[model samples]
Target: MASNGLLRECVQQLKSSKHDYEKVLGGSVEVVWQSVSSAIERHLRLKKGVGVPGLGKFSFIRDFQPLTPVFLLNDRFISSYGVSWKRPPPSLVIPIAELNMSVLGSEAGLPKDQVAQTLDAVCAFVGGRLQKGSASGRIPVGNVGFFQCEGKNLQFVFDPSFVKSLVQSSNDAKPNVKPAADPIKPTVQPNSVANRTSIAMTDAIGSISQLSLSRLVNEEPDSSSDKSSDQKNDKRDHHRHHKHKHRHSKSTPHLPLSTQSDTQTSTSTQSQQILPRFLMLDPLRAPPRHLTSDSKYARVQDSAYERETEDVKNRVARSAHEVEEIARRTKAAQLRYLQTKAEKSVLEREMNAFLHGQMEFKRNAKQQEDARRSSAMEYDAVKILPRDPIVTAAQRREVKLKLRRRLNDQVALKDDLAKQKRAVDQAESAYFLSKLQLHAAHEQEERAERQRIEREALVAGWTQQLAVRAQHEQLHPTRKHR
Candidate 1:
């Protein structure tokens, strides 16, 4: 399979010139990559052909069973970069000693000990493989290429194409262009199906010939042995003939004349019998009838055989043509499927990108809306509240002090009112008490005066009664005594 290194290189180049690419395509980095890759796959897989700007046209070649991709150099590209086989420096030939010194220098700006250690590691890896018989391992270095073991020796295989561009600019040492008159040596042809097929055919023919020679050698001994056995049987038959005849004559002596005559005829016929032989047994005699002459019938048979052979060949050719046609159609369909797949992938990527953008936009819009609502709520709250004059810290402090003083004054006034109310209640209670005391005293004095008056009246009455009683005493003395 051809490496995709060229494609990667092209992509890198496109990336380097992305400013112009984006401007022209009106897309971002990812979009450009998707579009370019999609287009390449479509043309190369389905159409079976695609062209690159600074490279060449690429296509699929169906020379044998499985198809392969190939790049047909454009005339411009060919002129700019002529092809030639390239050979990379051998692994064991690394001039690390020289490189290490320069690398260790301060101008290289690399850690000397670390670089030395890395060099030691590389050399060890290479030397170790060499000791282990063919030095077979990979020596990879990113996209640059790698050293690998090919056979007894190590070789490096470059990425993308194995061929190097020989073409150089006219300004670059004038290119040392030579005229066409100079004889050019042709390079070795690559191993391909044609060469393999020819080699296989030669090997088959050689094997067939060897098999035929062995068969002939093996059959020669069998034929000679059979001939010697036949000769021995003939000799044994000659010796037994006379003895068998005598015995047969003794046994059949009483036979009838008709039976005897029939027996005689049978014996004669048996005596005349000869052994069968191969056609080529007597080379001196004329060949078999078929080989000796050709008849009309033979001619007809030959023509029929020829016709059969021709018919077989035609059938084989037709079958092959049909197979080729079917393969062609299948390849075309495969290409179409590839194109459709690429287009679908590109569209899906675009759709995903678009959806992501939409989601991001919606999220941003929601955030903005939330922020606006918050701001509006704050504004509304401010509008509903009463606004006070703005004051500095000192002014606010002074206002607070004034407010405290006013509160203190109001509290004092309330305390005075409460005290006055308590004093008025106490005075009312004292006056009520005093009034009740005075009334009690006055009543007591009045009662005493009444008692005295009653007593005086009683005494006066007693006096008056006493004077009257004295006048009557003389007269009542006698009665009182009585």
Candidate 2:
């Protein structure tokens, strides 16, 4: 009854039935009471649907009664129109259990045993003021919701006049504002972009083909072949001459020292460019497999082969990191598993100890309960007498709290008093932090007004300790109670 749907429905019902609500709620007490009785009865008999207009549809189910002639359950099927919903039962609809349990958990620090006890206590506490959840009333645990008992529950009543007023208000509100007349615009026109890009790509492909055709027409194949033949004949003549001249020695005979130096510089420049590219390409592809060492034109290939080597190294590092993260996840999971196992073992041991403790508790409780039960049975068999004793015994505890308004006398008198046997105790504001001082002051005040209460509470404890001390004295005068 204190759920979102129920409270909202109750509010809407009250607002709709506002005119008749006062009359119905303020009628004779007898009439109102009779209406409640009749509503419960009518609710019990209903088999078909009955509308509560703004609230919901309700019906009843018949069941056998053990203690009475019949039992009728108040069943309401309230169709709540929203974006989406299912018709809920009253008990299922209420958030009372969750709200109270959550409240208990926060208040009591979520202890296991007393958590349920706190929840039950909180619910019982709420049950007292729930019927009072009217528009303006409040309750002890009002964080759950406000409770006001003044208004009627107008659950079954609905007025048709309110709906008409709502329609009329909607009609009257139309002419105050006008709708916008402009059309929304898009930034990029897809058709125009597609048409322009298609024409540009076609023109680029035609231009590439035309440029290639023009280069082929401008190039002369016969002249390139004649030049290649002449260079090969010149290379053969030079090699033959070098072979004849260098036959007498291991080193080739140089035409001049300057010519040898110029040849060495050209070879070194080519080697310098080729070695770095080889170092880069080796990691990406085993370049020796796909490339021939004799190919003198290897440097003319694409630069991506070199970049691929670095890319592969990056991929390897990334993969190593991923593998390490996976291993870390595995380690964390195993640690959690071992921790859970240890906790489970401890819980099992604690559970056994708790069961043993409960047995001892139950045994003591059983003996106490048996004594009370036997006393109750005996009292039922005869009349019991009440006693109020004439004697009043009290032990007085006198605690004097001394406050020195003047500290000057002590320091001044100390000049001569230090020559005496002993000096007065020295104290400072450090004494203000003593919990014992606060406790003593509190105990003194409590002891003054509630001496009888304190005596009643501590008499058994005092008697037990005192008897032990007396026995200790009897054994040895010099012995202290340990």
Report the lDDT tens digits of candidate 1 across residue range 179-262. Answer: 543133211123644334444544443432332211211222346556655775896787865554555666676655544644
TM-score for each prediction? Answer: 0.26, 0.19
Best by TM-score: 1
Candidate 1, run of 10 with poorest lDDT: 89-98
Backbone atom clashes (below 3 Å) for every candidate: 1, 6
> Model 1, which residues run further than 4 Å from truth?
1-141, 144-291, 370-482
Clashing residue pairs, backbone N/CA/C < 3 A, model 2: 132-147, 132-148, 132-149, 133-147, 133-148, 134-148
Model 2 agreement with the true structure over 34-116: per-residue lDDT tens digits: 23233333432322223321222333222211111111112221111111112222211111111233333344344333444
Model 2: lDDT to the true structure = 0.40
What lDDT score goes with residue 206 in model 2? 42
